[model samples]
Each structure stands twice: as C-alpha cells, then as structure tokens.
Target: MTLIDALIQYGLFMAKTLTLVLAIGLLLIVVLRARPGGSGDDDDDGSRLEVVDLNGRYANMADTIKAATLPPKMVKKAFKAERKAEKARAKAEAADKRRLFVIDFHGDLMASEVGALREVISALLIAATPEDEVLLRLDNAGGAVHEHGLAASQLLRLRSAGIPLTIAVDKVAASGGYLMACVANRLLAAPFAVVGSIGVLAEMPNFHRLLQEKGVDFELHTAGEHKRTLTLFGENTDEGRAKLREQLEETHAQFKAFIAAYRPTLDLSKVATGEYWHGEQALSLGLVDAVQTSDDYLLAARAEADLYKVRYRARKRLLQRLLGADGARALARPLARPIGSVARWLRNLGGARCA
Candidate 1:
C-alpha cells in the first residue's frame, strides 16, 4: 500500500482501539460513581469523623488579616488585648459554656450526602447535651422522595433527643429539601434563598410512538393493575396517567402534613402550592423562622457558644482521589460523545461494500 493509504489504515486502527478503551473506561467510572460510599465512607480501610473548632478558625483568620494591615506594635497590642478578653470570657462562661455543632449537607439529586450527615448525627447524639444545639448548613434544591424522606427522618432523630436542631439554608431548600428542613426546630434562610416547594412530581418520557413508527414491538407485563403506571417504553393510557396523578397528589398531601406536624403554625393552604419563594418571602409565609444566612448565625453564636464543624471523611482510592466524582463525570461526557460517533462511523464503514 502507498504511504498515505498505510497512514490512513494506521489512524483508523488507533481510532478503533481508543474508542474501545474509552468505552470500557467510561463504564468503569459509572460503576464506581454509583457505588455506595463513593465519597470515602463505604470503604473498609480509611474513614474518620473530622471535628474542627470554628471559633479558633475565626480568630485565626481575623488575627492573620489584622497582622497583615497593622504595624508590629499595634498587632502585638491587639493580640494582647484579645488574649485578656478571651481569658475573662472563658472564666465567666466556664461553668455554663454551650457547644454549637455545625454539620454541612450539600446534597445532590440523590441526597447522597445523607451518609455523611448520618455519621455526624450519630456522633452528636452521643456527645451533644440538651444545652447544646445543632446548626445544619443545608444546601439542596430537592430530590427523590424516598432519599430526602430518609434524610428528614435522620434530622428528626436529633429533635427526638431534644437536642434543639436548627437548619440554615443559604441557597435553596425546596421540595424534598424542604422536607428535611421542616424537621429542624428552627430553620433559617438567606434573604434570596429558595424555599418551600411542598409538592410531588412524577414524570417520564414515553417512546411507544417512536417504536411504532419504526415497526418495533414492545411488551410489558404486570400482575397487579397498578403495578406500573406511566412507563418509558410502553404506550400510556388515561387510566395509567390518572393513577400516577393520584399517587403524586397523595405524596403532596403527606408532605404538607409532615411540614404541618413540625411547624404547626404554618398556613399550608397558601404556601404548599408547588411554588418556591425567596428567603424573605418564606419568612413572611412562615416557611422559615428567620431570614439569616448560616454564616451570620454562626458568627453571632460564636460570641456566647463554642462552634465546632463536624464532618465524616474517608480515605479515597487513588482513582477517586485524583478525579473525584465531579471530575469523573466531566471526563465521561467528552468520552461518551466520541464513543458514540466512533461506533456509528465503524458500523457505517463495515456496511460499505468493496469491489
């Protein structure tokens, strides 16, 4: 073969090999991402709960900045004055000093952070006293009913222990997120945070029409009449749609009831309309107790209480440590598109006849 033709052949071979490798790699990444405790907990080898002194951290930050701008004499004077004040405050409050335990739950659509939250809550249940309080820095836009429901139930454990649970939302606590937030004894939200989407949603795309046009046969079998409703592959009927709607309505009612049980003073009729409101509006509607960000709350608490941020950390595998979950997803998208294109090209090339 001519050099040009040989080069083309070699390029095609490399392309095929690369496509196969990427396809396998993408599959492995998906499996790893889906595995439970991908964030470090499920692994048997390396996991621990991390407790950080927020009070000390805040002081250090202030001191560092003060030292940067102030002259050496003023810096020393400031440090000495702060030390005197700290000793006096520590002496007076030594007998009744309260602890504020902070936990962060940055949830995804699956409420996967629930695992780490579980560890934190368990630790608090053992160590926290009735005088102490929990401030959950929660940021979630809502997600699966069952997942967020479990997360809510976990928060309820603290309330059951009379530990005074408080949840602070800086960005959003809607739908399933609201479900978890309502479990708190006091819920705080930032002025622009989204809150209160007390509604149920169920939806799926049906491909029966496309299959019919392509002369493809699809069959579904179920023993019970309501076993499957509003499916993805099969044709949907009015009866199935109606049943799904009924289920959604039932879930919405339960959600409202759950919120009412926690915040008995809320007017469910006005706020449970499947619409979210900003934090200020939520405060007016009684969806949140106050319009304050978590940072503000923590800063204020730092004056009278010792603040500690608790977290669960697990040792990560080499691959997990390198790419992490988000990185793996970012890598997967580029890999998946090229794999599909290469697959189609290979199929088309194979179909072409030679003379």
Candidate 2:
C-alpha cells in the first residue's frame, strides 16, 4: 500500500479501537454504579444512617421568612441581634440541654420497614442517654402479628435501656400499630387520626366445591392433623373451622396480654373488640394519651430541647433501583416460581393473624 493509504488505514483502526475501549469503560462505570453501597458511603450492611438537625432547619425557615419581610437595611441588624442572643443562650444552657431524637415509621401490611428500624434503634442504644428522649412519629394501620411484634420489640429496647419513648401518631395507629404504640411511655395522636383496632382476624376462600364440580382433585399431605387447618383447595370440615377459631382466640389473648403489660391502665376489654376509633375518641377510650399532631409536639419540644431526626435507609439493590421494587420482584418471579405457591399460602395465612 502507498504511505498515504497505509496512514489512513492505521488511523481508521485506531479510531475503532478507541471507540471499543470507550464502550467497555462506560459499561464498567454502569456496573460499578449498580453495586451495593455504590451510590454513596454506606455501612457494611449496605445502608446509610442519617441524622438531620431539625432545630437548625426550623431556625433557618423562621429566619428566611423574617428576613424576607424586613427592610434590607434592618435585615442584617435583626439577624445579627438574633445570632448574638442565640449564641448567649447556647453558651448558658448547652451543658444542661437534653437532646430529643425523632424517627418515623410508615407501616404497611408487612411491617417491611422493621429492618431499618432495628438499625436505627441499635445506633440509639449506643448514643442515647437516659436524659435523651426518643420520639417515634408512627403512622401504621396495623399488619401481620409477628412482623409488628418484632417492630414493637425494637421500641421496647429503648424502654428497657431507660430511655424515655414517646410515640406520636398523626394519622393511624390501629391494631398492630397500637401494639407498638402501647409500649411507649407517652402516646400522642392527631385529633382525627384513626386508632385502636385491638383485635385478630383470619379469613381465606375455599374452592374445594368448585374443584369437585369440575371433576378435579387436589391433595395435600401434612404430618400433623392441625397443620393444614382451613385449607384453600382441600375440603374443610367443622373440626378444621373450630380449630382455626381456637388458634385465633389464642393469638388474641396474647395480643391483649402484651398491651396490658406495657399499658397497665388501659381497659383492654373495652377496646379490644376488632374496632377502630378516631383520635379524640381513642383518647376517651384510654387508647391514646393525648390528641395532638406530631408537628405541633415537635415544634413545642424544639424550644426546650435540641431536636434531631434520625433515619436509616437501606441501599436498594441494582435491579430494585433500575426497575423499582415491584418491577424488580416481577422480573424475579420466574426464578422464584418453584416456591411461589408456598409463599403465597404463607402470605395469605399471615394476613389472618393481624393485631
């Protein structure tokens, strides 16, 4: 080949090689970003614990509005004077002032956030003193017994450690939610918030008759007689129905006992009837200590104590972040199909054991 032609060919080869290299580098970057703890510096458990100074945020909001309303010339002088006053107060009371840590729990049917709650509690158990107070802004309408039971036990850890626990329910804290609330030293709720569904219930549909009409047979084998009580496909006898009721009663008794242990003064018999009430009525029923929103309580508490909002956020896996939680689960359904039936059965069974 001529020198000019050879040079051109070499240049083309170099360009292709550079393009391939760039593509591989970009792929590497994407994969690294998708890894656990890749988005930021997270804990060994692929989580991040954040504590925000709510007092500073509240002060900033007030200062911003105050500055906007004041004349430009006076704005500087007013802020300066406020800063001086704040510095003097901090110096005088910093040593004696107690801290109030706040956290939030927005519950669902599974009480799925309990894992993050455990991490937050673990951190507080080490950092918080008896003088420090904890406020849980809880909004849960209740869920599975075992899941909420675990969540409530995490709160009990604070009480056990001598740290005062206060629960503020601005919306709803019914059934399993109440199970956790009753454990608090003080429970506050919004005026119209729903509360108190201190009861247990289990229900499922039986399709044995439908299968029999279609000339289809479904068989289930269990080692124990009560192991398969209230089957979905198999025929259910009066004995099986009675056994399920007996089990539900047993769970209900345990639930009532748990509340009584934490809140000795509550009249469980009056409230534990599978019914819910609004916040004002809940207070009358002795289910909540006071009818007040979380915001008001935090605002009032900010004046006396330094308030901080603590949160534990688990890093989402790559698929979760890419497709969202539900979509990721859907994508994995085929791989999990082997145990899908059993998982659904257990999930339905758990639905019956709500607080």
| 73-133: candidate 1 lDDT, tens digit per residue | 9999999999999999999998999999999998766688898888889989999999999
At residue 173, give the lDDT of candidate 1: 87
Cα RMSD for candidates in order: 8.7, 11.9
Q: What TM-scores do the predictions have?
A: 0.83, 0.82
Instruction: Kindly list the per-residue Cα lDDT of model 2 for residues 177-242, writing each as its tens digit.
Output: 999999999999998998888899887878899999999999989898788778888898899889
Off by over 4 Å in 1: 1-23, 26-44, 321-355
| lDDT of candidates 1 onward, in order | 0.84, 0.87
Which candidate leads the pack in TM-score?
Answer: 1
Give the local distance difference test score of model 1. Answer: 0.84
Instruction: Quote the lDDT for 297 in model 2.
Output: 93
Q: Can you give the lDDT of residue 260 in candidate 1?
A: 93
